[model samples]
Target: MFDKNHPHLFGRLITFIFAFWLIIGIALFSLNDTPAEINQAKAQTINNVGAYFWAGNVKDLGGGFIKTGETLLEGLGSSIIRISMSPRFRIDYNLGGGCISNFSLETLAKGPDLNPILTNPSFSTIIITAYDGTSFSDCETKNYLYPDLYTPEITAAIEQEYKALAQYLGTIKGKTFIILNWEGDNDIYCGTAYGATANSCPNYQKHIEGFTKWINARTKGIKSAGVGNVYSGVEFNIVRYLKNAGLPSILYDVIPNVAADYFSYSSYESINELYSGDNGTKLLSDITTAKSAISAGGGNNSNFIIGEYGFETLGREDSKNKLETVTNLLHSRGVRYAIVWNLLDSGGGFGLYDSNAVLTPSGKYVCSLYQGSACFIIQSPSSTPTPAITQTPKPTTTTVPTNNPCAPTSGFASSCIEDGTKIITVAPPNISNSNLNLTISIDIPANKNSVIWPTGYYWSATLKNWAPFTLQGNNYPGSSWLVNSASTTLSVPYSNLQPGINYIVTWDYIWDGSKWLGPPCSTLTNSLCWRLETFIRP
Candidate 1:
């Protein structure tokens, strides 16, 4: 009101608004192609979003952990941040190591134990996969351990916690995802607690399949335990378990497991203690071994994640460095997420948060996961090209006599000539960064008044078709243009295109010009087009 009262300020404000609008312009996403009922759509991912919490290896990495943890979490940038925490007793990363015993994820996520924790924004995909103090409950449903599929107590716990997590997520759609990490028994040899049991293998899968369906059917916003961000006590173990159970990629349903799109493995600096090394037969190269298997399977099969990879605090500086190196390496290769261990007070020197609640170097490493958005390439605009126009002759205005023969090679209208393989010449072969660059050369005789080139040619990215060169070069004296080819070299600014985009129509030949000399390549138009009869690949 006061600014308006002064009058001049109001005038200045109006001018400023006008100037701002002129300079800023409008964004495409916000545009409305409003035709009363139509509106533009934006893309969104519906299945799952995963992030890893880096905690494990606090004490062992040594001092000044608080700052590091903060840095690490902040680094997650745009990824759905996460925390695969455990009760202090079993999996505290601060000092004590992760689970020594196992329990169902349902038991861990149940009521009374949530509330305060769910409130933390630092958590998105929360899974309490603890394996200490408790053993896999064999007690079955109705009344027996490992009965129908799950143990009774185990089923109850999973049901209870699942309901709680679902209800909590219901309040905030898209903001967070609460995942239940199913437990695996310490079958040290095969590395799966279920130890090849039908229930643990085939039956266990069926149980999970039905369970997720049942849960999804019951709730509205609640997502099933999509089995995401799985941390391994070992990576190979997951593969080994799958192979042992005869579970194919389809069964892993990795492609369909929208909720659990990533496979995790556990690799501690303690790899030697848990896995058999080369001394035996096959060398257990930790994550390197696991990653290779996943890659060889298929690119679309599943994205690998080094979910729980941390070393003990007692680990030497050399060991600690190795751990960090391994973590970064896996992360680079589409291992979607990587989480250390829980931040604990004591036991294993491997917590991200130390005994004093400080974040270790590993903590800083983890915080990096939470901090910023992932690097996105500025590629879309440069790759997509505007389609070039090629003239299509509509059989001219007059009709030809039914008994008439093909047009003579010596005259104007030559459309009747057999469209035999016409060789088009290309210029500037080597393209930078794989951009489509091309120029076509077609044969044309010169000097008899003028020469004409063909209009209309096909271009195929898959088949690699060359466009007809329609432009008539060296005809400098007059603006009377003859041949025109539907060809151009686009400077696509990016790396190698994926499978579907390997080949492209480097040239499209077509002409609408009236200068139709003749198709006889040996005569008048020969010099113009003949110069381009052959082309060599770069």
Candidate 2:
């Protein structure tokens, strides 16, 4: 017992005892930890991510078409997931080509419903676009608008299904929210196609009435579930609301009529209004105006959310910077969530990643945010080399007769003028609130036949669509003001303007004889040949 190995036995026993106590101490310390503290240890951060109409192709499983939602949810790294399903899930309405028709909705409504997304523990927020009819052409031709799919049976089915969904959402641990919405303003409820003027798009009046009832039914259904975790929302393209001052605007027309819990803005125009390296001036102004509009329409502005925002063909570097800038500004404005347009490139070029699985600069930044890692800095592009100047003989310009009241003036109306035989200006010089009090000025040379007064068409660069207007008291399209008159000014009070975005108003005039009496500006691409005025709302 006095051997060297035998003498160390007591010391070895003490060392073993110390290791056991150390393990026990660590376990006891963990007992007092919060979920957040444990998540911090695992480096889990909050992620609000969504896709645009993409849940991958569903597989035909004979009984019904279904997909293992987990496969796609695994690497998404999102705390919120957005998916879409066609309204014609139970029965085909023959809604035509552009409409999204599949069994995804039925599968969600029946067995294994909501489980596709809820089973994935990583996601706490779920947004479902229950109606995916996004065809403007179909709206014109077949009247394939949101109202077309609504019926007594469909409404009941929607209510029953969402009730089940809400009940399930209530059982999820921690804070969870589910939002249900439809196609939004993507369908052309108001525009030139239906000859929509400021007062009416008469042909689609039934559609609007039907839509209001349909939306109310949907919200009622969601509320019937009696769960606080579920909310009803309506998506509106704020840009469209601003551009088209005519009928069928969800923000102005439908929202006030429905009982939606939140307003989601598909904000494409907001992205277009941003300048490089913006310090949140334009973006914040747009959001503020949008909130005011929502509030005025009786919607809860505090619940405003960005349903969609993205950039395509802006190059990955610029897109990344723009997206990051927008997100930071939205966060500053106290927005709870925002969904990028899509995850994978599906030809619109709005995807975070390309078809080949290559991560775009924007995608990389988003991924970093999801993973709680610092984003890689995208270097600004180098300035292009300026071309050397070359001297050439100057061509002589002929002097034209003057009396152009539409001449460019200083300050707010600096860029309001367009000159020719007939001159035009959208607003008189140096005046604010020009958009609200829209003014169009024109002058014609003396000793000419009486000129046709101009009719206004509002152009939305984002939608590449024109909203044609009829002069007050006129029911026909292409209605003009002060016909067979010259050298006059016309002012109309327009109250539906959304400020902080540039608007292009093209006034068509048949000059003493302007170029070949071209088709209406809405149908033609040569917008420059027409008398146009562009201005930003102050």
Candidate 3:
């Protein structure tokens, strides 16, 4: 009896020991991950996250030296960093020791702790400027025009510099995407004035002619480099086209005329004016319009990018919201890449972090996207002293039915409608950007009979046959319906719906004997007709 009991107890002890060891191993593996492993894990979680942070106050954080640029990169978990270089400005372009070229790629790459940025496998995208001009004040006389300023000799220098840079980048390990682009819409095109009319700008025609030559030279330099991973692109503030319609726009005039690899939109137009008020309708339309223009200009839609998007915190209190709106729209739209305007706040509150290096709401939100949760990770000390944390009042909350179909989900803002009810209003879809660039029309078949309702009714649609349908509350307020056609077309911008989700659009009509009117079909009877269309917004 003693021998038998001893064998049983030994077996039980062995089993328990094995289980304990397995648990310990898991904890150790998770906790002891190397910095590279941790960074790789973080990189796998997000995509196309990047920003442009240059020129800010410095901070001394003891032994580990950190600049605002470094902090910005770490905080945002940036996979891409846009670095500008002024090759001509560099006193020592080859050996790289100079004061005038502080922001050049060579300078930044060789700076303290920044070499890792170039060598590290984490950063997937790097946009480098081939040539950056501080100001083209002499353009009034055409002396600063394209061939004049960027003569063959200058273009060749640009090419050789870029080729060397490309060769160096190629020697580095890991597959990295590199774009050699140049100054976007600047005084070269718009002159010294910000909102100058196209015609009124000094030598506008000559400037465009000069720019066309300048961009082509830049593009040729980049292409001539022959780096497999490197491509040339042109960046333009898209608003230049919208504000000056019928005039030669960047997409219309230059892009089609050049052989650049991609067109980067410095998307201030959408962020400041077009995207707001509409549920991303105008923004989507504008992008579509821009893509069409690019296609006409000999570029494909896939190569389009939002190169720079940001809002200044100087006077705009809703800067955070505005930033999030554009970011979310781009993500949802599946645009290849987007870079925020800046990282540090110098004078303009454009930086995600203030001059003190403290996290701003916009910065925090960006960090959350990278980390997959709430996070604020500072790699080094900022130059400016950090301020004391303040507690602000929480946003007010309004209660709505959990089952409400029109209720917003994650990544969306609050809606005007609070009460849970059936659809009540409809409008002819005139999905137009503020200035008009794109349009989408949804047609309701004419054969379907009207379901008349006097109180109110809304055109509704369900998500993959979910119990409730999601509708925009503000889409209907007054009577706006078209009855004079075989199929009444309604406008529903793809921006209204979330990405990766299946949506079904259902429509109903109310007739007053004279004309079919009222919006949003209500579920009054079982006999009502339903049209099912599956839409996945990118």
User: How much is the lDDT of residue 63 in candidate 3?
Assistant: 22
User: How many pairs collide in each candidate, listed in order?
Assistant: 83, 0, 15
For model 1, residues 298-371, the per-residue Cα lDDT tens digits are 43224554445454423323223334444434443344555554443233565554543344565544444443
Compose the digit string of candidate 3's lDDT tens values, residues 344-452: 6544677676655555677776776776211422122112111110111121233223354454322221221123323322222233552111122233334532332
Each model's TM-score, in the order given?
Answer: 0.36, 0.49, 0.53
Question: Lowest lDDT 10-mer window, candidate 1?
Answer: 373-382
CA lDDT of 444 in candidate 3? 31
TM-score order of candidates, top first: 3, 2, 1
**How does each model score on lDDT?**
0.34, 0.48, 0.48
Q: For candidate 2, lDDT tens digit of each residue in 399-469?
A: 21135423321111211222334344455323335434454444433453222323444443434444444
